[model samples]
Target: MKTLDFKPKLVSAIRNYNKQTFMADLMAGLIVGIVALPLAIAFGIASGVSPEKGIITAIVAGFAISALGGSKVQIGGPTGAFIVIVAGIINQYGIQGLTIATLMAGVFLIGFGLLRLGTIIKYIPYPIIVGFTSGIAVTIFTTQVKDLLGMQMDAVPSDFIEKWIAYFQNLTHIDPWSAGVGLVSVAIIASAPKFSKRIPGSLIAIIVMTVVVLLLKQYAGVTSIETIGDRFNISSQLPDAVVPELSWETIKGLVAPALTIAILGAIESLLSATVADGVIGDHHNSNTELIGQGVANIVSPIFGGIPATGAIARTMTNINNGGRTPIAGIVHAVVLLLIFLFLMPLAQYIPMACLAGVLVVVSYGMSGWRSFTALMHNPKSDITVLLLTFFLTIIFDLTVAIEVGIVCACLLFMKRMSETTDVKAVYDEIDLNEDADMERGNLEHLSIPKGVEVYEINGPYFFGAGNKFEDLMGGFGDRPKVRIIRMRKVPFIDSTGLHNLENMCLMSQKEGITVVLSGVNEKVEAVLRRNNFHKLLGQENICNHIDLALARANEIVG
Candidate 1:
């Protein structure tokens, strides 16, 4: 039985807990919490929910993930990746549906961890990952255009093309005051790092822009701009936990959205953990992290929070600020909760345009343009997967893009594998000796017993190569009394390859021929042994090298 390791990183960090580390974690957590405040709000609003929901996510989900997660510095909350899917869910099924779907996704994540599928999730192709990420960036940028430009649209279209068209049509309704606030917010966020690395640029932008917009409206009588207070009510209290009522029909409808949330959450969290590992020189338990994420998602939605995952930017912030343990993540969550309890009313004064500006900067960071451009010079298959995933994400949605990208990548990979796998007949020593004599070269002679044949197989013996092996074996007009298969270059075998081998063995046995396997690697031999293939072929028939196999074949022929 496989032993399951459910140990959280927090427990390990606590074992060596010291005052100095606590101070570092406290300060780092405070700074990260400040940085998370505006982003949480922005992601929530962009996801078609109230700004407080974002804060709720950061506080509730953030705390749970930190306390139970595998990574020390990972910060979990609502992120830009969820905006498109969340908005679609809200629009189609309403908030209740979204709640149920998020809950289902949480269950899925827990299952993923319990099944120990963490390593498998990391194998998703880089091109597909980049493609969807870049696509999400584009989608996020597009979604923020209305607020950034202060366009007077009642509602932005969910469709990508239609959304752009709506933006163009509403170009005349752009408010200069709102645009000014947004641009200044962007400028401050972009340049604030030069002044002080300790303070986040987005936090600075939020503070200064909010005060500026407030002063402009109160003293100068500017009425064109919109603030969070003007749009949505800022709740100062934590939401009560409530179970979403579900029916069979509702459950059926929500499965796809739930799956999308679970998959994206898993991918983003794992990626963030991996990045944090590089920064801190620590390995994270991926399965444990997934379980933590699952628990967070399950608990968060009950408190009016959306699906949450590890935020790469916030995790980096924690690391840069000297956060070395999960305590910092816990502190960050506590700080956000405090802000929600006390500073919630003040947040209402924050300008929507400024938040939009913050999201635009976020979109820029998530764009992955550098990686995407680099991939253009890669193989045509990779490039194709990237482009296809990108366009499909924009045209349809992430679900379709991910599905198509994975399928396409798999097919292309199989094609390459098949191309590498080959089966060729090994010529007898007589033929080689004849050619050597005619060529007049100092060549060693080789001899083979009559009614003995040899064949060589190269590359992995997987499903893709099964047909090639079958075709090569089928062309043999006459059956030899003894046959040797040279597999020195073969690395591994799959069920399909094993099945084909079994068929070959049965046929050879019926024809009174002995089949000898040569140079089978340890991995392949393990599989053969597990399937009792060696017993079928007889232990004496298996050899470590071609010479031994030839000798064994000679004995069999004799």
Candidate 2:
């Protein structure tokens, strides 16, 4: 393993910074900042926290991730992915507990980076990712139905089934004005891009709907709409940095939640970075990105921000708008800070129903329904993992769903690997005339010495296929003077497979029969060389092709 490098992409970007790049970054940053405002507020409200926490996350975490991260254009903040987890944590463990857990999660993320586990995390199965994401999208949509319909429910239940039950029970109390505003919000967001792509649809929807709600309440006597001002206090000032109180008991109890947060944060941030890399035609250092995320998480929560990670939508917005460096991300944070200072008061008028509309749109984009439906046509095992993860996330929680999904994927992978591996006799006669044009003449007419045999092992020789190799070799009935094992198709071998191969070699040596290995691929050859298995088999017995092995076998039995 190479020594870990802690360099941030910003350092390099700044060195090559030019006037043209600065202009692009500035405009992109401003646009993305505007795009992030409503989303940050909506994610916060949906996660059962005050709207300020989300904005704080966007400003503080977003800045840290960009300034110190490995990706040039990543925007970090509270995303919809964490809504379910954060809401559950806040409900079960109060704000204080959530703070402690988040802090611990930050420590875990830092550890993940220092330990160089970034590349490993990326290997997580795609089916599981899509499954949990779709599940979260469904859950987010479910939570918003009450607000969207403007149902008069005192408090929505956290349980998936019970929340819908409450919505249905309060269906008669739906406020038409609130629902109308929400519908208008969604419509504006959906259609605003056609008029202009420079401004985000969500922002337009929030602005138009807030004004409409205010006007209707004043003149038309429609007053059932709930705005941010009615729900939580909107503060223009930044929050003070404070550490949460910690104890051994609290730390022990929070370990699980903390790990859950760390894992999800790492996965989402790296995934977002990978997407950004594709857009910019650059490769990001995964380990360095994880370290940057760790630092952001650690610092953001000190200012009363919720758990934050790379926000995919906002990052894409930045990329599409010409953000090519970390400066763009830094500028985005600054823009949000300006909004918090000057425009916070106006935000109070933004309707809860409108925020709900924004979340509904977010959930729909995240649902990945097309991918989910397309996966239905995949193999049964993949479909099983996808559906199991999806249902488990909704019925239980993300932690359970992810754990089970990985386990299922692993087992299925092992089964498929074992099925692909095979050990069988090579009974076909070679045609010498067919390969006359080749450098190595065909050994089709080459006569096999008496009491000599050939066998082929195909696919990867891992623990899953080791037993098959042993069983097939053990099934040989008659004693042979020489046995050639053809490994042309075997690309790699794990420790167990190597051990089994060693056992076969030792048994053949004891039985006074020469074991010749043929057509060993580079990877398999490296393993054999590293383990000194070639010496044990006698270097003269190893061959590059079956013809050489046959020649060696004939010489041995001559």
Q: What are the lDDT scores of the predictions, listed in order?
A: 0.89, 0.88
What value does the lDDT take at residue 112 in candidate 2?
A: 84
Give a tens-digit lDDT track for model 1, residues 1-558. Answer: 877756799999999899999999999999999999999999999999999999999999999999999898999999999998898899889999999999999999999999998888999899999999999999999999989988887877789999999998999999999999999999999999999898888889999988888799889999889999999988988888999887999999899899989989999999999999998999999999999999999999999999999999999999999999999999999999999998999988999999999999999999989999999999999999999999998878987898899999999988898788788776556343433112324645556667877777788887766556557765556767987887878889888888887888788789898899988878888889999987999888877766678778877777
lDDT of 2 by residue, 103-197 (tens): 88888888888888999999988899999999999999999998887888788878899988888888899989889988889999999889988
Clashing residue pairs in candidate 2 (N, C-alpha, C atoms within 3 angstroms): 430-444
TM-score against truth, every candidate? 0.91, 0.90
For candidate 1, the TM-score is: 0.91
Worst 10 residues of 1 by lDDT: 431-440
User: For model 2, where is the 10-residue window of minimal lDDT?
Assistant: 434-443
In candidate 1 the C-alpha lDDT for residue 385 amounts to 100
Backbone clashes in candidate 2 total: 1
